[model samples]
Target: MTAPVAHAPVPLQLKRGGGDAFIVEHSEEFVTLASTAPSPPGSTVEATHQGDAGPTTVRVKVRGCRRDPLPDGREGFRIDGRFVSLTRADRAALFGSQSEADPGSTSET
Candidate 1:
């Protein structure tokens, strides 16, 4: 089996104005979010990750969502999504500077 992806929980806010959400894990291609409500799969949503550079917003396509237990013992939704679009600056802000081109997209021409 593959090792689990290690990630620190980071607070995230849905641009559409939802209750609240947090990123439980993330990678260049996908993110798993813990949300108060279920986000339907195939839906596109925007979320911003506050990094040292500033708030980096990314558009994501919801792949799946399932019920999960929250830290407070309340029911929460575990939302999985794939990155739909990300700019070079957004990649640098969210994952730090990359000497080479980002995966799935190249840096500025």
Candidate 2:
């Protein structure tokens, strides 16, 4: 009898307008983060693979600034979402710790 093979998890990278960054790791899933403005509100962002598909909508509301203050008393941004898919490089950066492994480490689809 033949055995089934296991695949590694995927990694995600999110970049907001203000240079904010997010990293997510999952097997097969999607994520979305959306938020409203606060007079001069910013934006919400989510990162995903090129061809993967699924729900891609998120809604959020801006509350107040950060309690501890950020540099110039700027409040931190927040998002709500989930993981969808990750590219091979994203996977390595997240799971493999950016290590250089055998090219065959990743399975062919």
Candidate 3:
């Protein structure tokens, strides 16, 4: 079986506004995102990481977006995107590492 690529579900900066999303799943070519807010299609997403090492960025392009009902009876967004670029530090933050043993340490979906 192929091991899942380590993806850090960190907060992202939206073109118009900021919501939240998990790097729900990923591959070498793309990363799928699930957000708590709607992301406009054709927008660019940015994930920034800061630590002892410094800051880095993970950029993705929004391919599509949709709203889904949450279990709490609230609404959320499912944003599917493709990775445009990912720095090494960005990778470590998404996947687990000694620096960030728990990658997706951000807010819950």
Candidate 4:
């Protein structure tokens, strides 16, 4: 398995009641979302990202929770969680596309 690669941060949205959304900074295996209140430890949250193919949802477990003060002078909680079940194809789409062959590898015909 390859190490987690760094990609540009994207906002992930979780559908909530009354047309509300939970925005999060999402990566391949991890996501961070802001909230006015902190969730209980070891809670499960689902984040969904809609791509050209379809909507990819990942089950995230809240492992680390803390209070964060935003630069805009907003106070809230930050939820840090890891993707519980991220598939290979979804990983490629979310993080980045992984090349099948190594570009640095040299081969003899």
Candidate 5:
């Protein structure tokens, strides 16, 4: 008789959303948008990059949901939110400064 094989678990990558775009993370659900945001407990909120197209107002809506286990066996929270009419300054603060040549490029440094 052949022995059963065990498969390795996959890792999760948290991505930052752009203007009007928000990220959502959950045990089994993950999504991204340009107008909505996520409000998970202990989750840090920030603005998007400058010159990006989005809303001015940002809204985060969090629900009482459990997050999936990380590769390191750490627990996380599930959240969601929204952003309205975000300006260049707002984007710069939230994300980062936009590139001089590429309007869409965001400088993390």
Candidate 6:
């Protein structure tokens, strides 16, 4: 299976009743993040990432959360989640205007 695309440790905002997080990696199916708060499994969280067109927002289902080290060597929470839903436009906004053949478009659920 292909691996998730690693992203720069850019801060991602969790809009509406959430905390900040940093993107660790992502694929069409899943996104991993580092945050200061724990998200219980089966919960949904909305996160926004800046793109070329504008800010792309997505809701993810929390699969797991564990203690981990952040990029800056501090203790943090590592969050694993799957995309709750995505549309054609959302895909474009998240990974640019690239085709599905691109590595960023791995799997979608």
**Deviation in angstroms for 86 in model 2?**
1.1
User: Which candidate gets the maximum lDDT versus the true structure?
Assistant: 6
What tens digits encode model 3's per-residue C-alpha lDDT throughout 14-99?
43456455666776557776666666779877755454456556677888988864333457776677778675556665564533
Candidate 3 TM-score versus the reference: 0.59
TM-score of decoy 2: 0.28
Report clash pairs, candidate 1: none
Estimate the TM-score for candidate 6: 0.72
Query: How does model 3 fare in lDDT?
Result: 0.62
lDDT of 6: 0.77
Q: Candidate 5's error at 83, in angstroms?
A: 2.1
Query: Which lDDT values do the candidates have, in the order given?
Result: 0.72, 0.32, 0.62, 0.60, 0.35, 0.77
Model 1: per-residue Cα lDDT over 1-109, one tens digit each = 2223445566667787665677666766777878777779999877777788778887778999889965455788888987777887886776556553235555679
Regions more than 4 Å wrong, model 5: 1-59, 62-66, 69-73, 84-86, 98-109
The sequence of per-residue lDDT tens digits that candidate 5 reaches over residues 66-98 is 444333444544334333344466534434454
lDDT (10s digit) by residue, model 2, range 25-105: 122333222222121224334443222443222222222212232222345332323333445545444445332433445
What overall lDDT, based on C-alpha atoms, would model 2 receive against the true structure? 0.32
lDDT of model 5, residue 82 = 30
- Each candidate structure's count of clashing pairs: 0, 7, 2, 0, 26, 0
Per-residue lDDT of candidate 6, residues 9-69 (tens digit):
7566788666677877887688888886778898887888777678878787999999988
| lDDT minimum window of 10 residues, candidate 4 | 15-24
lDDT of 5 at 25: 25
lDDT of 2 at 53: 49
lDDT of 4 by residue, 2-93 (tens): 44333344444554321112445665466666655565679876667677777777567887888875323468667787778888887655
- Any residue pairs clashing in model 2, and if so which? 29-83, 29-84, 30-82, 30-83, 30-84, 31-82, 34-60
- In angstroms, the error of model 4 at 93 is 1.8
List TM-score per model, in order: 0.69, 0.28, 0.59, 0.59, 0.28, 0.72
RMSD (CA, Å), each prediction:
5.3, 11.4, 8.1, 5.3, 14.7, 4.4
Give lDDT for model 1: 0.72
